[model samples]
Target: MTDDTAVQARRREIASEHLLFKLIEYVEQRHPGLLDFLEGSLDHLGDPAHDETKDDEAVRQIARQMITGARAEIAE
Candidate 1:
């Protein structure tokens, strides 16, 4: 990759790390048990018998809501 492309990728990586830290802080403060629940849900989703389209959609919606809530919290 060109130097500019490499710089842009690095910037994205840093931004992602920042967001991840913020999300962790938010979860720890506002929803302490949520991380465990998400971990369990993700493990369940990996099962072949649990691969339902409706379930995937529901998870996506829940994730979107979590992200929205986190963003709002960060803004405050």
Candidate 2:
């Protein structure tokens, strides 16, 4: 959560511009380092959401990472 209401609203506005940012924010809020998975997946594959040429496996990998991260979070 941002300290200033304006800043937070602005952030939400920016995040709404892309699915990637929205996903990043959602995962970061609950499972910090899991973004490493998204970064790694993107390094290997194109942005499937925006690129019609790419498959959705990268997104699936991120979802898998999220579930794993969520489990780890719950364990802690």
Q: Report the number of the highest-lDDT candidate.
A: 1
Candidate 2 similarity to native, TM-score:
0.34
| Residue pairs with backbone atoms closer than 3 Å in model 2 (clashes) | none
Over 4 Å off in model 2, which ranges? 1-53
The lDDT of model 2 is: 0.62
What are the models' TM-scores? 0.42, 0.34
lDDT of 2 by residue, 1-76 (tens): 6569899888886676455545656677787776566555554553536556666676567666655655455455
Model 1 global lDDT (CA atoms, 0 to 1): 0.63
> Which portions of model 1 miss their true places by more than 4 Å?
41-76
| lDDT against the true structure, each candidate | 0.63, 0.62
